[model samples]
Target chain A: MRRLLLAGPDFSLAAVDPHSTPGFDGGKKKGAAALADGGEVLSSLQEKLFAESRAGSEIAVLLVLQGMDTSGKGGIVRHVVGLVDPQGVQHHAFKAPSEEERRHSFLWRIRHQLPRPGMIGVFDRSHYEDVLIHRVRGLSPAEEIEKRYGAIRRFEAEVAASGTRVLKVMLHIGRDEQKARLAERLERKDKYWKYNPGDVDERGYWDQYQEAYQRAVERTSTPEAPWFVVPAERKWYARLAVQRLLTATLEDMQLSWPRATFDVEAEKQRLAAT
Target chain B: MRRLLLAGPDFSLAAVDPHSTPGFDGGKKKGAAALADGGEVLSSLQEKLFAESRAGSEIAVLLVLQGMDTSGKGGIVRHVVGLVDPQGVQHHAFKAPSEEERRHSFLWRIRHQLPRPGMIGVFDRSHYEDVLIHRVRGLSPAEEIEKRYGAIRRFEAEVAASGTRVLKVMLHIGRDEQKARLAERLERKDKYWKYNPGDVDERGYWDQYQEAYQRAVERTSTPEAPWFVVPAERKWYARLAVQRLLTATLEDMQLSWPRATFDVEAEKQRLAAT
Candidate 1:
């Protein structure tokens, strides 16, 4: 699974098939059960984190999700992170650069949305979008994109040092899968709002987007926060993979419930009297 | 029930008993069942607000919670808001003013945290504390505090005009109820993080705090955003009342799923081929 999902020093996106469910071999039925288990553990871990936060624990988890259009970013949010308490999760969906945002360095807005202590923050489409979309579309100069890669590495390292476990995932789906998903959206009257012509226009630059994504994964997959390329053609697999990644990342943090600070027995006596 | 929860023009803190559950005839079990029902409705309403947000509907909901320490503000967040998608809820817990915040007007930070279009914003301990605590503790001078009443009225009115419905709640509890809650916290080893010695010190000025809260409520309970005085001695009742109040506020918005915008028939053909 690590060999399949983790972007390595010599990683090549061309070597992996987007349709392949690399680590998960079970059928969709089994995948559903695994996801449920993952969801339960994830919820408990998140609760422990925020509970410890009450005692001033600065530990936090940040899930940075970056993917192509219709790669199930919203699905991951609703299916996985939705299981936890809203107070424990801070969800920030970064849209196009506002007029004021365009004036500042890219990381300025990203910095403001970084999860505070003990939060499980999901960045719907994060800093990586800048390098991916901007590079593919030439929103920024080539030199600036390169500089951003280096900046992202250093920024992520600093975040890790400050006690945030950064789990980055790229929902890798093939061109045909994207087409089917887009078409499905178009077909359903209720989903028409989600279907944008801009998405079709972007599909014309498919090769460029693929190249941009490959470069981003290779460049930013640091030891601190490596990118996971989950085969998202099967959304069940994608959601499950992301959930498992989060579960492992949080377990590694070794967060514990806060210890008591008051006189427990005497207080218990007082409460019992009441 | 309306008489119990709604603060009227002739409102007096002295007239209401903290231990009384005036409107609710239900025991804790019934209260729990009602809370579950309210939770289900609140979740659905919030989803509609966000789903329709794509079409540029700016309507949102903000629940401002105010109370003395250990007043179950945290419980409401955990129980009621916790049922909804984290993506749809934005919670801000206001603390003491930072040096930078102290430099600005008191409403500055409050304005920044107001829920964006299509989201439910929760203030755990909100700007009301400025009036409640500041007035009781003499954190600011008398004239400054008096000026704040007018400022808050103006600020909240402007927010209301901008498509947000404000539901302000004061968790009303007596001194003895607070003592028992504090004692319970002290008893539970796991709850020590929630216990603060300052809570006990603040309780020394319980009468003054009540007076300040009464004045704040009487001064700022405008027609746009009336204050709900929840008798919070019974945690279950407090939770159920809050959930119902939020349900009604959201229902009043009359939000619905957005209409389709694309050519449905043509899109259906395109999807069927894929």
Candidate 2:
């Protein structure tokens, strides 16, 4: 999965097929079964991570999701991270910066939302927006846009050094798939709230957005915080692959429950009398 | 369920049997199945509540869970609230106050954690702790403690008036059940971190704590924000009851999908062209 999805030196978004389910040969039925199976594993690992936090362990995990409209970023959050204890999960969705937010450095708002120890933090859209949208729409100067890549690299490196594992995923979906999704939203009254007219304007910049994503992934996919471009045209595959990525990242942490801080036997005796 | 669980004018903590499942007739097997089924209904209601928020709906739900240690408050958070999209749930587990927190009003920290518009807020332990622990442990003067009940009553009244429904629940567990839970924690290495030695000390004051709870519930149970004393000895019953309470509260809101602000047909035509 890593070999297929991880953005390498020669990685290009155009080369990866959004419809392909790499590494997993299973069809939809097997993918659904695997996802259900993965939920239990993810929940247990998350609990251990949370338990370790009680012992003052500084470890945490951050998942940064970047993608176009209808790329299933919200789906990954709902289907994947939803399997764990909500108490231990810190989920944030970054919209356009508020007036107060724009007053600070781009990383300032991002820094404020980093997970506390022993949490799995998820960003629906994150710091990459500073480079992606800014570059695609000329929201920032050429030199300024050029510098955020190094800034993000340094920021993520510091985050890793502080015991937070950063997992960055970009959900890759085809233009046709996006149009279908937007049309479905438009057609369904229940989905109308999610149907934004601005999304159609953004669709016109599909190639520019793709170029922006390719550049962003190329510049900032570091060893500490590598980017995984998941094929997201098939929603099930996208959800399953991200779940595997998250579960595997947690497994690699190798966390265990913190030992009792007090004398267990004595506490047992005391508890009995109570 | 409402009639069976709601705290009324004649409510008494001692009269309510913690072992009895008042509204639910089924045993553990049926209870588990019911909980699983309820997750689907709860998830749908929660999503509607969230979607409504996007279109400027001020509606929200605040679940305040207050109980003795080992009363399965965390279990409800994991099994019940965990069923919903974490994106729409604001969960805050209040520990003992920090030096800074102590400097402000008890409600200060609580106001900060209240759910934003169109969110479900869960407080693992809530402002009720001020009355329960403070009265039991004499953490505050009798006069000041007396004043806080009215303060909380008025505060919740304003909270409800502003479009947030507050559901206060006290997880009622017998002393023996708490002792068994604490002993189990000490018995397992994986559970050791949850075994706080101070919990045994707290158990010594169980009767006083119950009296504190009785008085708090009596004083604060109002029409706007009623308290529900959930018999929590059966973990499954407690979880199912809370899920029902949350689902019912959300259903009462009668939220519908926000109408599209844009011209759907025009947007569809534009989207197709793009």
Candidate 3:
């Protein structure tokens, strides 16, 4: 069964297969080309969206990116969203629980970081970690973990109802690819320190975590907050797919600048006096 | 009198050419080569600093960027700090006061955005705005503003004393260059909306603002938080200067990754069992 939909009338999986197995290497090359193309498209789209949002002052965009280590989350952000006006974009990366964050529910830290109207907020990792890390580490009981998934869906639904359009992406990288990246980091002395022994411990649960992610993606993906299982083996393809998703989402909203009553000519003349 | 200092042992204004001007034609031909060189150096330095901060586990960096309109705060941010690990970098842009913000003291919102330990926080326009905007708009009495300046200096000194290195930059663009940018924005249909008629109104007070900025730089800049009046007429030069400043500052700190006590081989073997 097809889990995600690509752009246009065609629901063909060709757009999604570029990061899958046999075509992985070729997929990487093609993904790079797609990123270049998608990057240009997204840049133009983002500018238009920014202008309309600033002008109309109605809609806001919240881009939620969740992925495992080396899953190309940062790469997607750098290439696809880098062109937007910094003043209009806010990026928050949620890390290990702070004292204040641990004192509250998992969602508290993220709530304050939501974008205001007419702005874009990108979350590098989000509340989904409550399920991902807690489940993997046994931080919560099994029943409680299941319950939180329902809570998350409802929480996200409420957010959608409140004028924010959410784009959630889960970057999926294969075990072999993850191993290769880990090895590459070890090979370079400069990056050796970035490699944590704990990550290797996590890798032991590769299959279990993959199954966990698959279940999460299937269960949590909804019309209002669909999850894009972006294959991260090919970084370029992952970025392009995310960018295309973002552009399509923004276009669907059909945002435009708000109308103002200021007189342009008179204001220009007034400014010239200064 | 020299108001800004380059970060080096042989710091001298004589090393900088006052008459040098770089054009912004949007073509990659003009200052692209120089910008690229500066970008490469900045990226390498940023990478090293990030690695070190992650290892130290307690150090933080607060990068404060302030400038007039079109002084390339966005450009410098895009180029200089663009390559750092997004997970470790937090960017905050301060805008004109929202109703809620106006209800509190000016520094209320800013204090909340300071960098957490082992992270880098970039402030586009910061507490300095209180002095700049309040003075420009006459929102506060002269004595109150003066007192705030001293308070700011002390606040920053305390932050520096507390392991957060503060680096402030004032992007200095020429009056004529600013007019050219304003003209280009007005001419382009896509950018016309960005041209608020009030920008021209503010242009009349360009000299007054310049004097105000000069005074602010002279009075507040100290050993704990030195200011760099980067020449902004040339966007590449300004970015390069900022990159150099950041690189030098990070180098002075001699940062290294924190030592971790995990056995990678054992962890790998443990993971292999799963």
Question: How far out, in Å, is residue A26 in model 2?
Answer: 0.9
Model 1 TM-score on a 0 to 1 scale: 0.88
Task: For residues B1-274, write the lDDT of model 2, one tens digit per residue.
Answer: 8778999998899998999898899999999999999999999999999999999989899999999999989999999999988898999999998899999999999999999998999999988889989999999999999999999999999999999999999899999988888889988999998888889899889999999999999999999999999999999999999999988998889888889898888998999898
Candidate number with greatest DockQ = 2
lDDT of 3 by residue, A186-222 (tens): 5566776677766777877776676566666666778
Poorest stretch of ten by lDDT in candidate 1 chain B: B265-274
- The ten-residue window of minimal lDDT in model 2 chain A covers A265-274
Whole-model lDDT for model 3 versus the true structure? 0.70
Q: What DockQ, between 0 and 1, does each candidate earn? A: 0.38, 0.90, 0.31
User: What's the TM for model 3?
Assistant: 0.83
Q: Between which residue pairs do clashes occur in model 3?
A: A55-A257, A55-A258, A56-A257, A56-A258, A271-B200, A271-B201, A274-B204, B55-B257, B55-B258
- Please report how far candidate 1 places residue B238 from its true position, in Å: 2.9
Q: What TM-score fits each model? A: 0.88, 0.99, 0.83
DockQ-derived CAPRI band for the predicted complex in model 3: acceptable
Identify the candidate with maximal lDDT. 2
Q: Which tens-of-lDDT digit does each residue in A1-274 have in candidate 1?
A: 6556888899888787877888888989999899987777888788889888878888899999988899999889877887777778889999998999989999999999999898998999988888999999999999999999999999999999998889999988888889988988876655666777678778878899999999999999998989888888888888888888888888888877788765667555544554
